[model samples]
Target: MNITEKILARASGRQRVSPDDVVFANVDKVMVHDVSGPGVIKVFDKLKKQGINVDKLWDPTKVWVAEDHFVPSADKVSAENIVKLSNFTKNYGIEKHFKYGMGQYGICHTLSHEEALVLPGEVYVGGDSHTNTTGALGSFACGLGHTDVAYVLLNGKIWFKVPQTLYFKLNGKLPDHVMAKDFILKIIGDITTEGGAYKAMQFGGSGINEMSVESRLTLCNMTTEAGAKNGIVEPDQKVVDYLSSRGATNISLIKGDDDAEYEKIYEYEGSEMEPLIAKPFSPENISIVREAPSVELNKSYIGSCTGAKYEDLVAAAKILKGRTVKIRTEILPASISIYKRAMEDGLLKIFLDAGVTVGPPTCGACCGAHMGVLAKDEICISTTNRNFPGRMGHVDSQTYLSSPLVAAASAVTGKITDPRDLK
Candidate 1:
């Protein structure tokens, strides 16, 4: 069995399982954010009124809540939602809540890793689709709808149809100018957005082993753009060390069986890859940096669970060190802790000196909720997960997705310029 099947089987108390098999598995963790938590709480209330009383969550400690989607509240409604979430967490005894304006608050996925809430070989679920980002820790993490989340809260179990696994064998090392974002963009280009729907995308081989935990998280984070059920990488010493530094102990590591079944296998030579970009409107509409047309941008943004890690910001700061941005640009750290670290490291100073606005740690502009919403006909370059129409604001506004290196370089040049070209 593959890692996914093995984890599911163990959670379901079954000796073995196969693709498409329905199983009721115990959930080790459940995460809900302000955007989705209100809906879940509403459902829980509805259930109670129907005589299906759920006095409390299955395990309050195992459930985590974060107010991120519209932190600082973009509107009255957003504020009310946070209040609802706060009341629910307080009443339900959910001690793991990261409330708005709290020192520990951050994008849920980023905090989940920093807090070590999701561990290897565990079955976890979140209200947001990007929950798969946690799989970088070697956990079986995926997203569920609000109602589904409510069900898990009530019963501590959820049902799933096992997904077939697609193996990605990456080899060799990427160039200094290239990044996991470029590599993932290339994969989405090859497979198209819907290629891996209802399937598990398992990454392995020499290239993955050589990448840092941050880079690995970036890779797994975007698998949702390919419509995958989940994306995972086997845990190694690097992951164990990262978790340990965050106070995690007694971790359970799981690996794919040597004879694990896979629906298909794709191989790539990382050395041959270059910085790439996903053109306006679709993550799969990819083009090599040098080959892409000259596109002038009205704005550039570098932040999100997908691209706002410490390493990613450091890469951008290196390029923006003594330069000033030609267009409007914003840099937001994914978490409060990351923001503080960047400040101590002088990365935030570099960004400010470069004329980039450093904002609070919120989903903010990434989800078009606030901070940096786009105007009609505006063009922006961003280091974010999606480029769907109207994703960042107005329906006519366009967003091109790229690595932080590309985003920073383009901001300096005010055009779609390759980072290597600056060298």
Candidate 2:
């Protein structure tokens, strides 16, 4: 058994569990943002009509809320949903609500790490697909739909059929020009979007260990595009320090056993990895950034749970310093903490000097909800994870997904260009 099995086995209070074993594991933490919060409320309302005891939760302190999607409300309906979500949380006695315009608000997944809300060795679930992002902390983190989240809220438990694991071994440190985003894009391209369906994608090896916790978070965040049940990296010293710096206590690092079993093992040489991109319509449609076809890009977005971390901003700023963008560019830090760090570190100045717009932290436009969505026929190079049609705006709009470095470089050229090809 591997780390995943061990976690689930212990969670279910069993001596041993294997793949396909269904167990109602006690949940450690659960979350719902403004979008899913409202959906969960609707489920609660429906349950009330069914005469269930929807008045109380199993554990209010274990439940947290985020106001990310459609925040800085785009329309009357969105505004109303935010209000409804607020009331629901207040009524439920949930205390960790990160609201928009509040000092610490940000994307839900970003908050999961920046605030150390989800600790290692815990089973954490959220109402967004990208909730898998928290798995980088070595937790059995995954996403649940509205009804599923509501169940966890009331019962403090949810059943899952243990998933088979796929191990990705990254050897050595990646080149400075390459990033975890590029490595993940390459893996998704090789496996295709449905390749990891219903399986856990676990990363390991020297390269993964060498990567920063934020970089590992980037890797896990994009695993949703590969149709993975979840993505994870065994927690280590880096994970401990990251969480501790954010004020997390009782941190524990969990690792797979030396005899851990995996369905398949894929290996990659870090030096061979290059800047990669996923063209529009699907995340599996990938290509080397330098070999990309010529296309007129109307915008470049350096925001989202996938890319707007502080390290990502540093990468983009490194490219944009003393240079201006040829296309409209926007940089939204994943959280207010990241935003403040960029400001203090002068990364914000570099972006502003490069003529980029720095907006407040939100999941804006990443899910095509609001704030700088694309127009018809508009093309964009973004640091986001997905590239499906209409993902960032009009149904006809196209998106190219890349690392922050590639996106920043393309912003300076108005087309797909590698960071090394710039200047």
Candidate 3:
């Protein structure tokens, strides 16, 4: 069995086991966000009225509540929702409560790993679909609906059918203009939207070693788009170093056996993957752009839980170091801490000097209805998830999802150029 299998086995109370087995496992962590928490809270209230005891039911220390998304709320309804979420946190005594401007808050996925809220070999669940992002840290993390999250909060356990493992045995290197984002977008395109449903995608291969930690995180973060529980790459030195640097003192390393059995294996020569972009409505609808002439973007956004990372910052900085953005553009750090670190490293200066507006480390433009909202007939090239119709605010707005490098390059040229060409 591979690392995911091994971790699942241990969590399932088995010394060794295979895939698709239903099991009752303990949850090591639970998370909620303002966008999803109110829904979960309503369910919890109903369940409690039906005889579930909140204080006696679950571990308070294991649950986290973060207020992001419509932070400082763009409207009265959203502001009321945030207030309700805050009251629930205060009443329940949940140990981790993150307000919007605190150094600890960001997107649920980004803040989880940043604060070491998710740990290796643990079963973690969050309210948002992208909770699988925590799987990058060697945890068996997955997202759940509000009803399911409420049940877990009341029971500290949930049922899960083991998922078949899809092994991506990556090979080769990414093309000069292409980066990990393109690699993932191409994978999604090849597999289609529902390709990996009820599967555990275990990524490995020599090519993974060539990617930066942030790039690997981006790859795993979007696994939910394929309907996968989570995507994982076995813990390596990079994982250990990253955890250690984040003050994780007792991290456990999980790995697969040399002869581990996999449902399927895939080999990707990433070096052959061209700069790709996923057009709106479907992640698999991707194409290679050898030049930037195909797009006339009205806005370029370069941050999200998936796109806001240190390596992503460096990549965007490299492209915008001495240039100016033609269209309105915004760069958001994943967390306030990440923003401070960027400032310390002078990456923020590069972006500011380049005339790009840098927003706070929050889910600003990704939600679309808030900051950086689009105008009618506008197009945006963003580094976020799900490019559905009206996803970037205006119903008439079109979106092309790509890597931060592509976003930065597009910002500079006033069009979508391959980053390699700019070099």
Candidate 4:
């Protein structure tokens, strides 16, 4: 069995499981953000009104809630949604609620991993599609709809159809200017958007082993764009050390069996990869940074769970250290903790000195809810995930997706430029 299969099998109390096997597995944790929490609460209420008694969640400690999307209340509707989430969390006695502007708050995915709320070999679920981000820690995590979330909240279990696994074996050392974002973009370019539909993408080999936890998270986080059910990396010493630093103990590392069946296998040489850019409108429309059409930018943004990590910011700051951005630039740290660390390390100062506007830790602009919405005819070079039409603002606005390195370099030139050129 693959890692995903092993985790699901253990959770479902089965000795062995195969692809397409349906199982009602026990969940270790369930995460919900303000954007999706209200809908889940509504579903829970509707079920209760139908005479299904659910006075409390199956396990209050196991359910995590965070106010991220539309955070700081972008509008009246979003504010009302936060209110609903707050009321529900308080009334339900959920002790793990991270409210807006209170405590350690940030994007749910980043905060969850940083706080070690989810761990290896666990079966986890979140209301948002990027829940698969937690799979970087060796867990089997996936996204479900509000209805499925409500069911998990009430019963601590949810049904799942075992998915076929796709093996992505990454080898060779990465070039100095290449990053996990570039590698993932290369993979997406090869496989296309729907390539991994309903399958678990299991990453292995020396390249993944050499990557930091932040890189691994970014790698898994974007698999959702490829239509993957989940993206996972086998646990190693690096994972264990990260979890331990965050106070996680008793970690159980799970790996694929030697003869595990794979739906497909892809092998990539990290050293051969170059910085990649996903053109406007589709993540699969990728091109090498130097070869991509040279387009001017109105704004450059570096934020979101995918690109707002400490290492990502540091990389950007290194490029922007002695320069000023020709275009408007926004820098958002993934969480308050990350923000504080950046500040201490002078990364934030570097960004500010480069004429970059540093924003609070929120999913504000990434999802187009607030902070930095684009106007009509505007073009943005951003480090956020997704470049779908109207993703960051007006339907006519264009968003080109790239890594923080490329984003910072482009900001300095006000165009799609390569970071290596600056070097």
Candidate 5:
């Protein structure tokens, strides 16, 4: 078994096991953001009113709550919701509570690692589908629906069907224009939207060693899009270096035995992949923008939990150092910490000089509510997940998902174009 399998096996109280075995596993941590926790709280209340012991749900110390989607209160309704969420946190006494405007809050997944709440080799669950982001630290993490989260919170354990393991071995060296995001888009293109359902994916290859930890995180963060239960890469020195920089050192390091069994294996040479994007309505609907026809964009965004890392910011700044963003484009950092680091490194000044709107480190545009929303017939090139029609606030609006460099180049060009083709 690999690290993920080993961790899951231990948590399931089994010495060794194969896939497809249903197991009752204790959840190590549970996370909820303001956007989803409110609904989960409502369900918990209903369960309590029906004479169910809500306290019997998960332990309070194991829950992490953050105000991310509507931080600083975007509007009256949102403000009221924050108050309600605050009340819930107080009532539960959850130690991992991150309040709004604290400058310590960002998207839940990013902030969880920042606050040192995620520990490697543990099974964690969150109310958001992107909860799989935690797996970057070598943990078995997945997203659950409100009802599922509520049940876990009540019982501290949930029944899970063991997932098959798929090994993706990457070969060759990646091109400068191609990145982990591009590689993932390529994988999704091959597998389609629901390709890896109920399967845990293990990524390792010659090319993986060349990718930075932040870049690897970007790749693993989107494993959920592949319909994967979880995604993992072997914890190498890069992993140790990254955690050490973040003041984290204690992590369970496990690797698959050389003779460990795997259900499926695929090999790929990522050297030739160009910058790719997933069109609206389907993550599998992918195309290399350079070869695709031009599409006018109403806005372009260059930040998200996936795209707001230091290297991501550096890439965008390098591309936009002396250029100006189109009037409709915007960019935001992942969190205040990231913003501070960028400013200290002079990257934020470059972005400001380029005329890009640098909002707070909150999830500004990703939520489609408080930030750069779209109008009718508009199309946005964004780095966020899910580009369904109306995702950015207009039902008729369309969103194109791409990397920060692609989004930055598109914002400057006022159209969807590849960064390599620019200037």
Candidate 6:
């Protein structure tokens, strides 16, 4: 079995496992956001009426909460939802709730790594589809629906049908102008949105080893766009170093067997990779940055768990530094911690000097509601994972998803522009 299988087998207390094997794996960590928290509460309400024990979580210490989407109390409904989540966490004694307007809150997926909330060889589950993002830490992380999450909260375990692993090998290091986002976009294009459904997508090879931990997280984060069950990379020294910096010390790495099996193996030459973008309406509708459609872009959004990491902000700052954006641009860090780091490193100043709005670390803007959203007929080049119609605002508005460099470059030109093409 591959790394994914190995982790699942261990978490399930099995000596060995394979694709399609059903097992109830004990969960090490679980998360819920404001939206899902409320949904889970509703599930609990139903469960309570059904005479199931819904009065307490299996382990409050193992449960965490994040207030990302619908944050800043987007509307009256959102405000009420946050209140419900706060009460739920308090009642359950879950101390890891990262609330908005509080000291260290941001997107849930971003928090998974920044706060060292999840570790390698664990079975972590969250209520958001991007829960797979934490697999970068070598955990068997995946997302679950509201009822499924409520079940995990009460039972401390959930059943999963083992997913076949798809191994993506990067043969060489990515060029300075390229990013993990480009590579993932290229993969989504090749596999299409439905290709990885119910499958584990594991990244490896020389290029992945050469990439930074945050870059590897970006690669795994977008695996959801390919409809994958999870995305993971083998834990390494970099993973340990990263978690240590975040104050996590009890780090144990996990790796697959020498002859680990995979459902299929795909290889790519990272040196030959270039910046790529996914056009509106589908993550699989991709094109190289230089080959993107010529159109007036109304906005350049560089924020989201997928693209608003510290390194991503630095990459955007490098492009926006002395170059004023030709169109409106927004830079929202993925978390307050990253926001502070960006400010401390002078990245925020560069963005402001470049005439971009540096906003709070909120997913509202990236998810396309209650923040700066696109107007009808407007087109945006964003550093986000998905680009479905109305993903950002008006149902008629269009979005093109790209790496931070490409988005910042296109912001300067008011058109789809590659970072390498910038003067």
Per-model tally of clashing residue pairs: 0, 0, 5, 0, 5, 0
Of the pair 2 and 3, which is ahead by TM-score?
2
Q: How far is candidate 6 from the true structure (C-alpha RMSD, Å)?
A: 0.7
Candidate 3 ranges beyond 4 A from true positions: 291-293
Q: What TM-score, computed on C-alpha atoms, does each candidate reach? A: 0.99, 0.99, 0.96, 0.98, 0.95, 0.99
Q: What is the clash count of model 4?
A: 0
Each model's lDDT: 0.92, 0.93, 0.82, 0.90, 0.80, 0.93
lDDT of 2: 0.93
Q: Mark the regions of model 4 whose C-alpha exceeds 4 Å error after superposition.
A: none
Can you write out model 2's per-residue Cα lDDT over 1-423, one digit (the tens) per residue? 898888899899998899999988999999999889999999998999999999999999999998888888889999999999889888989999998887899999999999999988899999999999999999999999999999999999999999999999999999999989999999999999999899999999999999999999998998898889889999999999999999999997778788999999999999999999999889999999878999999999999999999999999999999999999999999999999999999999999999999999988998898889999999999999888999999999999999999999999999999999988
In model 6, residue pairs whose N, Cα or C atoms come closer than 3 Å (at least 3 residues apart or on different chains), thus clashing, are none
Clashing pairs in 2: none
- Runs of candidate 6 with Cα error greater than 4 angstroms are none
For candidate 1, what is the lDDT?
0.92
Stronger candidate by TM-score (2 vs 5) = 2
Candidate 1 structure quality by residue, lDDT tens digits, 1-423: 999999999999999999999999999999999988998988988998999988877899899998889987889999899888889999999999987576778899999888888899999999999999999999999999999999998889999999999988899888889999999899999999999898998888899999999998998899999999999999999999999998999987898788999999999998898999998899999998899888679999999999998899999998999999999999999988899999999999999999999998889988899999999999999999998898999989999999999999999999998997884
Ranking by lDDT: 2, 6, 1, 4, 3, 5
- Candidate 2: lDDT of 80? 99
The lDDT leader among the candidates is: 2
Better of 4 and 6 by lDDT: 6
**187-279: candidate 3 lDDT, tens digit per residue:** 888887798898988777888877666777888888887788788888777877887888888888888889888888878886678887888
- Candidate 2: worst-modelled 10 consecutive residues by lDDT: 250-259
Tell how far residue 283 is off in model 2, in angstroms.
0.3
Cα lDDT tens digits, model 4, 1-423, are: 988999999999999999999998999999999978988988987998999987888988898898888887888999899889888888988888887678688899998788899999999999999998889999998999999999999999988899999889999778878888998888888998999899998888999999998999999999999999999999988999999998988987788899888898999988788999999899999989899897778999999999998899998998999899999999999888899899999998899999999998888778888989999999999888899999999989999999999999999999888898974
TM-score of 6: 0.99
Name the lDDT value of residue 199 in candidate 6. Answer: 97
